[model samples]
Target: MTAAVDVRARLVDRLEASGVLTPGWRQAFLDVGRHEFLPDVFWASTGDGYERCDRARSPERWLELAYSDVAIVTQWDDGTSSGQQREPTSSVSMPTMVASMLRDLDVHEGHKVWEGGTGPGWNAGLLARRQGAHNVVTVELDAVVAAQAAANFRALDIAPTAVVGDAAHGYLPGAPYDRGILTCSVRHVPPALIGQIRRHGVLVLPFAPLFGGGAVARLTVTGTTVTGTTATGPFTGSSAFMRMRQQRYQAPPVDDYLPGDWPGDAVREYTTLNPLNVVDDWLASFVVGLAVPDLYYRRSNNGGSGMTTLWLFDTGVTSWATVDFVDGASRFEVRQSGSRRMWSEVEDTVRWWTAAGRPGFERFGLTLEGGEHRAWLHQPANPLPSPRGQD
Candidate 1:
């Protein structure tokens, strides 16, 4: 136990020396003993001496990882308990990522803050410790995680209000917060979160676009509007956060979606890139999603040939379309007998990105209206006058 405490101290010391830890943040890191919140066994991906979790052989090792400046996987696949599987569905984020996000949030003392996605209450605890406990409120989508987080906070004697519900809607009961932080990665900025912030308040979250990719975006809210830019640094890492409940998932059959028989000269292939790298390039995909909202991609390998298949789910009706890009040009087809021109949407979005000089996400800003779930994108030179104009 003493060795574990020493190791934790060393990790905190390193973080502080790295200049990423502010004075208040350093104190918070020291105060919050992560071992108390984690289970007896947990995986460590740091590539340090320890890699796998073993409660019997090394209880001390597990406890050490819990306290170190690293994240612990707590859940896998919706409600699957950590003890059941190795596939991580949810985790307490890494200390550096957590600290970086808090720094981006820039929450000062005594400010009313609303936090979305309370994993293990570590971040909530940090907010309550910095701001008054009475001034912080956190929301979690899973009841079990919420209950565990509540207990974690209670153990520390920090009484921040922790609610179990979909954070996509934002906790409106505690309205007009000074700052809002979303720890989860979202395909789109939730309109409710924007509405929940007071004018001039700060909102920080990871925002990605459909089709693929995302980034940490920081926005400032003002009377029914928000404007902000993306942060640049090492990628914070990828998270499999549950999509907003409203963003339903549906996939059409492969036959209907595929283009006519492959061209004689077509050659299929595949490649892998870090998922974080994909999110960093979200601008390319956002342009694609806006133009082609129903796009989905699948990767496959058949020994000799490998390719990624693209499908378009038509929102206008029950039908969808398919496109295959083997050698270069895309071959299009339709499936499920529907009325919407899903193919047109995908092509149009691609054309828009091409015509816009392929501007990156840095050129775009997002604005959210308070008390409502609507978000708008703004360009420095050509601000989107209205959300209706996004199409």
Candidate 2:
């Protein structure tokens, strides 16, 4: 047996033991060769930034990463450049995320499946194995990536109909699907996606808020185009997937907010809550984002001062707040300005989350109705409170 096969078996063994790989899906997991879909070069996150890995230069490490539980960056800047000059646009998603999403899909034999963002086509390949190849339709917005995925599928002799278009709209030619899964994340569930699914059909995707954190949403479609379609489901687990290309955020430049000197007309205040805790914890970020909408942040380091500043801003480009932190310091300095108090909103949201015993991602559920997404704690009836001020 080859080393790749040995590592793939071990990876499956670990996932099965973790309970993400179920009994029915074991054969599909064992059969799909993930490495077959990889490109010559990929990037892996090292916390600070992404590190480039090339198959030709380091074959052993590259093969190990192919099966290991990590997202490998496949395309950069939407296929515009091969050099690592900007953020990653496409990737083979993390293995655990892949397994968990498949579990959430709850697919059955003969069920027609629609997949969005067929990065390297591994997920599509796996779906075709369980459901027949004819019943699966995978869509990709990038034509180049789509062609590569098609070639990979052909090499494996597994032919799932591949469509080159925006996944947000889905493939109408194969509509009324039993299941729809998105490999990328979206700020909110699209109305178009809901209209394409049959009533009571499941659609699983990573739902992220503008603030920061995100989770896997497993929703069941209801109603119709004429009847006001909606989807409701609980967050299955925490996830960090690239946002859909069409739904990407466009924040205003820092100069637009601060035209002159720092804290030109800003208010100043201090709080004991460490920005470190809020910035580091994924669950905390999720809570803050769910509670407060239209809010986001950026971090910076003071020049050799051992001080870090966490800056918060709204999508409106009117309000800005900065909280300065130093290692081992009990009190941190803060400054705020504009009509809406962005820092106050974040601090209030974080405190509320802490007071409520800090629920995990599974405790939260989402409901998309009337063209708006509402997040709730435990059940859909009780919606999370939206921050007072907005753009």
Best by lDDT: 2
Which candidate has the top score in TM-score? 2
* CA RMSD, predictions in order: 6.6, 2.1
**For residues 21-81, could you state the per-residue lDDT of candidate 2 as single tens digits?**
8877888888998899999888876565776889999999899888888888888888788
Clash count per candidate: 9, 0
Full-model lDDT, candidate 1: 0.62
Q: Any runs in candidate 2 off by more than 4 Å, and if so which?
A: 45-51, 225-227
TM-score of each: 0.72, 0.94
The local distance difference test score of each candidate is 0.62, 0.88
> What does candidate 1's lDDT look like per residue over 339-372, in tens digits?
5444455444555556768666555544443322
* Worst ten in a row by lDDT for model 1: 229-238
